[model samples]
Target chain A: MNPLKLVVVTAGLTQPSSTRLLSDRLGEAVTRQLADEGRGVDVHVIELRELAVDIANNFVTGFPSPALNAELEAVTAADALIAVTPIFTASYSGLFKSFFDVVDNTALTGKPVLIAATGGTPRHSLALEHALRPMFAYLRAVVVPTAVYAAAEDWGAADAEGLSGRIARAAGELAELMAGRPATSHATDEVIPFEQQLAALRAQQ
Target chain B: MQFGIFTVGDVTTDPTNGTTPTEYERIKAMVRIALKAEEVGLDVFATGEHHNPPFVPSSPTTMLGYIAARTERLILSTSTTLITTNDPVKIAEDFAMLQHLADGRVDVMMGRGNTGPVYPWFGQDIRQGIPLAIENYALLHELWRKDVVDWKGRFRTPLQGFTSTPRPLDGVPPFVWHGSIRSPEIAEQAAYYGDGFFANNIFWPKEHYMRLIGLYRERYAHYGHGTPEQAIVGLGGQVFMRKNSQDAVREFRPYFDNAPVYGHGPSLEDFTEQTPLTVGSPQQVIDKTLTFREYFGDYQRQLFLMDHAGLPLKTVLEQLDILGEEVVPVLRKEFAKNRPAEVPDAPTHESLLANKPDEVPVEAR
Candidate 1:
């Protein structure tokens, strides 16, 4: 079996964004789980704050910038994606959302996505289910069943053990999703039309 | 150990030169500041969203998605995602698309937004802001969790067996933080859903944010998500640093007085005294910020408003250097020392998703 490729996307631009920290932890957990499963996996992490120009330009022009083009390529090629954002109001941030507006509609077709968010309190945790999940659903991406939300209190202290366990569980689910390969019956289906099948069979006889 | 800087972008004139940086230049400077934050060892970067003049981050996700490709470790987030104004459906799809682009280092702070007229611009009413926030969020949650949703609400049109696409990365949605400066209703909303509550402690005194955070903590426990102490909280701050305390004050004073946000309203000294804006050496910033725990109790994330006040980009970069080298390290150590063993660190994507309850099967409504 081919190793799964996981990519983590973060919308935190500051040095201490909770979203990014959470995303990195998720990446680490996924990597560890894959390793434990004896399946080699390649992980890619992309931070959206560094690509400000491409994002801004793309929005104005209604087209993908060259830099965004590369990012789109990465998404299309990846096996799964982990996306994290901070909840703003009752939804995802404009910076986090605008990055996706430029991608080709088909880029995320059938891709698996893990959604997560960080907020100051637990109230906005639902933004994942309400705002983020539907967005990906429209894009035709296969979002993971579980969504992780870390309230501000989640990081109030320095307990790596608790945080790591949560990450590992999310990663474990991702591993399971990746491990269950979809059947590829279309490829094996006989190409001959129904009418042609009889003729082909007769000819073979 | 995540760290980064955020720019509340403004197109301000260089007071000395009488020349204003274009919106483009100012926006680019924000990116440079983010890079500098990362270069200096901070972990994440965020920008605010304002649709009006003097504010350049009208489209934050676009900016963050662009930044995603350039840096490796820096997480990109928004100081505000206008949940009150923007359509919830668009919000869901856009961030999910960004999730694919940036990999997974994305999260957002949801706010009702400060601007009044922006509501009409987006075909919404300011009077309906709270209800909009509640209703739209409810629908958004369903869209992310259920593969197909049938939702009918007062604000937006109903959804009949609709499915939002580009399934969230790994089938999990991005984390959410509800940011409120003075609205208890917003805090209540956050607590009701067990989300993070952010008090951007920039303008008001500690007492104001304290009440808000206190309410959130109390209600979080009421909802049975966790203990009040386990309620997630994030705070916002502002600082100006120099090697010498006196120099920091001297350099920052002129900019503070003339800044568009609070200019001519209060003396720079008075404003700093009243608000979380700290002006002095790195030690002063560290000391003032550490005291936040004293007022708000143990908290999860801390963000600084470094790039506001019309400060030049060069000066802002210098601030990041001080923050990375002198300020954050000390605070990190101090925060860790005081943290209790039973307390949990703030949630990240990993920690939040680790413990899973069985999925609730949905029936068509």
Candidate 2:
């Protein structure tokens, strides 16, 4: 069996960013969870910090740079996604939203996404439910129920559903969602035979 | 392969001088450019059609009609005639009329026009763009072929036993090419009819066009339109040349920085590297252009966007002279060398008329 391809999208602005740390943790946890069930995995991490200029340029130019396009291609074709972002004010960082904005919204439909965030305070933890979950829902991605939030203190603290525990739980849910599905092959230019397109139009009218 | 220039007919201000040509001057300039195209030994001269401001060519056939009278050798065509907004019957009538006047020196490319308001202004919903293109072009295709036609579609009033007059010169309709920036359905539509598929290779990455052209070729063969290599293809390019490569870049940078549609987005150097836009000496332009056939597999037409971005008429004329004398002669020779005979040249009135089957007119039937 081919290894399940997992893509980790981290919108970490700094080199020592906890957002990326959370993303790596989530990626590792999911691989372990899937491994326990004898499933092999191939993990690919995409750091959005390097893509900031490309993302902005894509908005202005209405086309991705070749480098950005390659990363987008990977994200769209992966079997599962682990998206981690640092919280800014009341929502995910603008860079995080911008990265997903460039992705074709429908490309994530039925994709298994494990949404996680890191911020200075645990007060913003519910942001996962309000912001990330709803956004993925709108994109039609099947976001896992156990969204992990690793606030500044939670990283060093041990509470119920601690950072590590939440990561494992979220990873487990993502693994289950991914385990039931095959590796996705998002053929970019999937041609609908002209006849069928005409037929579909005829049906519409 | 046919080589020519395609212009959006944009009335833009020169970024360096902040001077915009009046609409009158722009229109005359297009005619001058067409005549220069003929003098320079270019094979085709295509113009874009846009109804909105800053774009002058609203009625393509009107301009092509005038150009046909002035030029002898140029194959007058359109970057795209709006297939969605314009009535297909009118398109059929107009181009056929132009065909007669031009003595068959005409072909047309079909495109769904840009901008949302152009749709409502023409009584169309932007959401139905694909269907409108399909239905309208289907009618235009039928009108040019059959003497009379009965047609019913969702968008327009049905026609019964109606004839589009001045029937395609010598019983062969103008060859149609579907131009698309990013639509697979358009590519498939072109392949289904064995019509030409033109990729607007100027604004986007080459990879995008490679995929599009690849799909078009695969589907062209699938639809029994000969082998993929035999499917007719056209590509768009943008080039600015000077004696010195640095001079070309330096002179074109202001226009590149502020040009409409894609200006101020990517740097000139990045745009030149990523897309087909080349700003350099004649040799650099030729070297970059020769790689296009390598990427697209010996296409039938290569049209450059040369006259836009407020390029002064004199400068544009000079660029044409360089193209005709220095660049294109070399390109023509290089493109023709080791070229497969199966790959057709850009279809023209004569080739199409000659290839027309011997058949009785529908009126006689």
Candidate 3:
């Protein structure tokens, strides 16, 4: 059996960001869960902060830089997605949202995604549901129900019981959803053959 | 291969001087640029059509008609004439009129204009862009090929026994090239009609255009338009040059940094590395241009964008002189060597009339 390809997108702005920490933890948990099920996994991480300039440039120029294009292909070709972002002003950071904005709207349709976020306090926790979930839903991705939110306190004292448990449970859910699914073919980059395109236009006519 | 220049006809402030030319001066600058193209040995001069400000070439035929009067040999074309918003009947009549004025030195590239609001400005919905391009071009194709077109389509009022006036010159409709940055449907349409496919090779990386041109060639063959090598292909490029490569970069960096389309995005170096944009000596321009053939196979036309980003009119005219004198002559000779004997040149009115005389409409004859 082919190793399940997993892509983790971390949109934390600062170096040594807690959002990336949460992402690594989530990635490890998912790998552990899949390993427990006797499955091998291939994982890729995308640090969107490093690509912020490229993303902004894509907006202005209408095409991604080659580096960003590779990252976008990795995201689109994954069997499952683990997207984590730092919450800013009650939602995912603009950089996080902007990265997805550059992705083809239909590329994520039917993709299995596990959404997570980090914030300073637990009050912004529901941003995962109100903001990230609906955005993925709009893209028609199958968002895993158990979204992990790691507030700063959750990384220290509050992490004792509930945080680890949530991480395990969410990881398990994603592993179950992704198991036995073939790696996506990066179809977004494939040219739709001319005959089919013509037929489609002709059908509409 | 044919070498020419295409302009967005932007009214930009010269970043170096911080002075903007008035619209009248800018328009005259464009005319002067066209005259310079003819004076130089360039093969074609194409103007882009934009319905908004910051861009001035909204009336392509009107501009080309004026250009037609001045130039004798230069083939006047469009970077793109919007196939989505404008009425097909008007396009047929206007272009036929242009053909007459320019002595059949006319061809057009069809594009769905990129500006979103221009759709509603012409009473069109942006969502229907592709369908409008497909349906509108279908009607326009017939309006020119068939003297009396009886047509009905989704976007426009039906036409019954309507004949577009001033039929195409020499009983042959002007050649059409579909100019698209990314649309596969437009590529298919170009292949379906055995017309040309022009890749706007300036803004994006050549790898992206390689895929587009490769698909176009494959589909052109699939549609029985001869072998893929025989399919008509054109590419757009942008260059800035001087005697020394560093001087070229030093002079172009300000304009590249402040230009409207690609400014504030990628650095000048990265943009040059990532796209067909070359900022170097004449030799560097020639070397970079030759590599395009290695990627897209032998092509028919090559048009460069030299006048945008408010590189003062003097600078533009100098660039043209460099292009005509130094770059294109080398390219023309280099591209011709090792090129397949069977590959045809870009179609001219004379070639079209000679090659497919039977296809000309009866009334046109």
Q: What is the clash count of model 2?
A: 0
| Model 3 Cα lDDT, one tens digit per residue, B1-365 | 88999999999999998999998999999999999999999989999999899888889899999999988999999989999999989999999999999999999999998899999999999999987887888788888888788876777788899999999997789999999988877887898889999999988888889988888898899889899999999999999999999999999999999988899888999999999999999999999999999999999999999999989999999999999999999999999999999999999999999987465466898
- Cα lDDT tens digits, model 1, B219-285, are 7888788898888888888899999989988888778777766654555675676678899988889
Q: Model 2, which residues run further than 4 Å from truth?
A: A196-205, B361-365
Residue A137 in candidate 1, Cα distance off native in Å: 55
Best by DockQ: 2
Window of ten residues with lowest summed lDDT in model 2 chain A? A182-191
Whole-model lDDT, model 2: 0.90
Task: State each candidate's clash count.
Answer: 138, 0, 0
**Model 1 - which docking category?**
incorrect
TM-score, first chain, each model = 0.81, 0.92, 0.90
Worst 10 residues of 2 chain B by lDDT: B353-362
lDDT of 2 by residue, B1-365 (tens): 89999989999998888889999999999989999999999999999999999889998888999999888888989989999999999999999999899998999999998788999999999999998998888889899888889988888998999999899888888889999999989999999999999999988889889999999998999999799999999999999999999999999999988888778687888778888999999999999999998898988998988998888999999999999999999999999999988887777777876787788777998
